[model samples]
Target: MEHREAAFRKLFDLYRHDIYAYGKSILKHDEYAEEIVQDVFLKIWLNREKLDPELSFRSYIFAITRNLAINFLHKAANDARLREEVFYKSQESYNPAENNIDAAYYDRIKQQAIDILSPRRRQIFELSRNRGMSYEEISKELGISVSTVKNQMSAALETIRNFLFAHSDLTLIITFIAFGWL
Candidate 1:
């Protein structure tokens, strides 16, 4: 166990910076790049027993880093698209009163969805949306890495979106706008 731990530590030390650089180049975001580094290393450690010393360790690690970074970007892009769709829908002239629900009812539903979030996630969400703080700003204020803030915010948005979809008659766009995700 000690030997494996030492090997993993050495591997991390050797490749962490290189992986971070690769992720940064691809993502163009420092926080996400840092996350790729951590996630890649965690994956490597978990799968250490499968490590083949005969193969180029650098290549193997870089492949993992690249794949994870790509996945991260894909998810971010999809989330952005969903938000845009919701925003566009919210801007339409449809009247909520036609559906027999007032704006305040939507507000209450939004609050209920928010109330369902874990404490840290709710804080992160509020910082990003309500406080109008950037991910980097929230990270610095909360004394956490930017990646952590981004992850929490992403999770909070998804949770709220799901909650609104399942529990309310409002369209996705209306729910998103009412929840201030736009």
Candidate 2:
């Protein structure tokens, strides 16, 4: 047990930032990167007793981080596309001069899409995507059936797709749609 703890701790110290940077590259958000790194380390620590010392812990951690990063990107991209669709559909009044604030516009759209998700659905989506929790893990954590998790994920994907297709061209929609399929 002591050796396991030590090994996990060493692994955390060695690769935390590299994993974080990889996560940031995928998520493009410092806070989300921090959260994902911490979650990966927590999982490693929790499963340390089962770890094989001879295997490359770095590879294991990198795999976990990469999976988490990809999930976060999918969720974020879906959320972004959904918001853009909603904004266009609503015909919200906007200042023509606001084009100068491109970053603000993007942020607002992201937040709006996130806000549109139900609280539990949003949390589940975020956890599954950003933290790389599998269906079983998420089901256990949330006290829901795996079928429910799958249904929620499908709903999330569908909502994003329907919203995007309503506002964007087929090409842009299809390109973004590929992420969900993948």
Candidate 3:
């Protein structure tokens, strides 16, 4: 374990700045580039045992970094499209106050959506979202497994999305999402 940690640390020290630079070049965002760095190193560490030492590690690591960066871009593009379709293009959202729909209304819609969740699911969602707690922190606090916390959080979000879709305006739903109520 110590040997593994030492080697991983050495590889990280060697590649982190290069990875960050390459990622920033592709992503054009500093925070996402930093995320790419952490994700690249994490992937490398998890798959270290499978690495072919005789092969070019530089080529391999860059391949992983590029793929992750592209995937991030793809996901971001999808999120951007959602914002475009649901929020920016909507006249109602553009003048929400004129329409008598504001942050408080969005909060009400969010609360209604959240009310549809089961008790345990609501607790997990609130802990993770409202309290800004990490899954591991919520798990420790609730005396539950981390995976259980993750699963419950996923389900809670899906339930809220469905509820919002069924019961509220798309503008309200998107407004909550745009503001990261989910």
User: Which candidate leads the pack in TM-score?
Assistant: 3
Tens digit per residue, CA lDDT, model 3, 1-182: 89889988998999999999877655555777899999998898788889898999988878787778646644544597644643444443365345564666666877878898999999999998889999999999999999999999989977876575456554554455556665
Q: Write the per-residue lDDT of candidate 1 for residues 43-158, one digit (tens) a residue.
A: 98888778888999898988787668546544544586644553344446676565555566777887999999999999998888888999999999999999999889888877
| Candidate with the larger lDDT of 1 and 3 | 3
Per-residue lDDT over 42-158 for candidate 2, one digit per residue giving the tens place of the 0 to 100 score: 887778678887998778887788666545545545787743543343334556676567446444544455467788888777777668899899999999999999999878765
Error of 2 at 147 (Å): 20
Q: Report the C-alpha displacement of residue 127, candidate 2, in angstroms.
A: 32
Candidate 3 worst ten-residue window by lDDT = 84-93
* TM value for model 1: 0.44
Query: Could you tell me every candidate's TM-score relative to the true structure?
Result: 0.44, 0.43, 0.50
How well does candidate 3 score on lDDT at residue 152?
97
The parts of candidate 2 lying over 4 Å away from their true place are 1-6, 77-181
